[model samples]
Target: MTLPSAMTFLLGGLLLAGSVLSKENPAELAVPRDTTGKSQWVANHYKRMMALADKSPEKFRIVFVGDSITKKWLDDSGSLWADNFGSEDSPFYALNLGVPGDRTDHVLYRLKAKEDGGLGNLDNPAIQPEVIVLMIGTNNLFPPHDAEQIAGGIGAVAKRLKDLRPDSKLIICSVIPSNSAQKDEELVIPANATLSALAESMGDDVRYLDLFSPFLDGQGKKNTECYEDGLHLNEKGYEVWFSELMPMLKETLGLATEN
Candidate 1:
């Protein structure tokens, strides 16, 4: 071969190798916790959780995990959380470990062991709960990831959480459908299915909560009235989420009635 032809072939091979490396299991890889730019608030939240774990982890019977959508609920739901989970009459206490704009890998990072380079919150036995509710992966769907890759990322986190606390239950909420049904069909729907399967495979203590349909109107468009920005939920959206969650909480925690 001419030198120029050989150079072109070598360059092509290098490019293909790079593509393969780039595609390396991003979903399953546990990236470090990000605490910059849009996610700067994560640092403070992490600190708060670690301190709470050190001080009083046992008080938290329910741990909610997800992205901005989950964080906003803790910030905005106010009485909804207190009246049911934190009140004197309530049977369970809860903690919010939601980090805004976080993808599946970021959450896996937080859930992994510190010696393994994650935040290691789940490594603390005192932080064990009766049930862990996870509503993540919407951010992943918003990206170029397919259903399988996203599910893999979410599954890694879910499986690890259950593995760490074998006796505890896990409820994996389906990705809340986006504004476009076509996109939801492409990614969200299948991811939801995989989540359901993943929950079942994890055993009887694990469950998959379907939170997608309630957010969609009869026409299948995301209900605008329920959303604040076509992405995050408004109070109406929270009500939709809350209705689903309340029943799951009661059933999973084995409570006789809603608080």
Candidate 2:
């Protein structure tokens, strides 16, 4: 066939294939809806579990739950959390249930299943988590989503946590400081604002802690050694986390504040 004729034939075939593909994947054609609520549902659920722990007597088993930052703290080959809290022999066991690349939506599902003891399952009704440390909203800062939506999603997750475990203590940690200078920092600020606001709105039942300030040097930017990347914390960073967090734990659990 001539070059022009062959080109025309190929175009016709491509169009037919495209039509078939579209029908097979209707989702591609559908308009995307806002995921703010969906994301917040997970946050709500986490908060429920944290609230449930507050009523527990004796030791309060705590779980730090979030994305890569939370996961790294748990996966410490040296057992950073365990060492900081003493050990399994300590007053309370700190369970690391942080999953990598997880958004608020992922956490909501995990809580229902009790896959990591963050949220104990119905079958194993014996286990009850006393506290939950929640820090999320990094990924939601991308385009097409605003900070309010991200906050709403996180709020929903907090609600769910409270509902599932009404007695647990809910501690909402500020998102660790971020240093990306791109996009005029608007993307970063809104999400953090939303998270901080949500944490405050929970009242005394849910407490909020901000660690962003300590992680910084004289500069407003993040301390270089505190984080491996501009996002996640390093050992020095976790050290800062532990220093600030240990006191909160003692106070929340009614341990002796005097050191």
Candidate 3:
């Protein structure tokens, strides 16, 4: 395919085949970020996960990838994480590869091959997933990005994830509800709908999980009871999420095993 002289390629440290970059979704282009506090956090967490994977790579069964919400599965979820996710004798050990303020492109940068400047966990055999869950896209809900664009970004990430781990069952989760006035149901609802369709179009091994449904109240608002601030989840919120996720995880594991 020949390109126009005006067009430029998305080069460097990004997995293009499994990327979130295109003309329409250019805002979500995958690129490594090194902002001050965020850079420190990303480096620290990446190192921690690498160390854990190096020590007992085989113990990693479930890998949840996303931003702060997924990262806090270990922090805010507290004992819930300890007891259910990775205690001495839990059903499965998990890797929390969530980075705060991550967009789809950022995740793609991280998921890129080590030779490509990414952490390359996907390329690591021992750190592969039995069931991998991708819960991102919320961070990309800013100006000029609509629901379709966000969903497209997530779809790109899902494709990248499966390409890296074809043997693993992939779960693409909808952006959970938050109290951000900007990221209200107007945006989240349609984005999730598009993601649902995207999952089905991807075929049998890939599926979509909705995090928006259970995290709501009778009032159809962000259940303040489930939120830490306006966005991130508190302990109560994780409980709400874990209830749905646990069943899905078990079922996904069984299906993955059968395969």
Best by lDDT: 1
Whole-structure CA lDDT of model 3 = 0.80
C-alpha lDDT values of all predictions: 0.82, 0.63, 0.80
Which ranges in model 3 have alpha carbons more than 4 Å from their true place? 1-22, 35-38, 142-144, 255-259
Write candidate 3's Cα lDDT for 77-187 as tens digits: 968887876753566678778888888888888888988777686777777778888999877874537777788788889999889888989989888885674576677
Per-residue lDDT over 1-259 for candidate 1, one digit per residue giving the tens place of the 0 to 100 score: 9999999999999999999998876877788765799767778878876675665776678888888888887656656766766543456677777877788988888888888777887777778789999988888865658888888888988987887888889999999977666768898899888888888898899998999888877896778888888678887888888898888788888877647
Question: Residue by residue across 51-162, what tens digits does model 2's lDDT show?
Answer: 5434332343776777778867754424666665425567556655565556665566565555544344222344455777777656454432455555565676677777
In terms of TM-score, how similar is model 3 to the real structure?
Answer: 0.84
Q: What TM value does model 1 have? A: 0.85
What does the lDDT read for residue 239 in candidate 2? 80
Model 2: per-residue Cα lDDT at residue 156: 68
Among these predicted structures, which one has the highest TM-score? 1
Shift of residue 259 alpha carbon in model 1, Å = 12
Please, what is the TM-score per model? 0.85, 0.68, 0.84
Off by over 4 Å in 1: 1-23, 36-39, 87-89
- The residue pairs found clashing in candidate 3 are 30-105
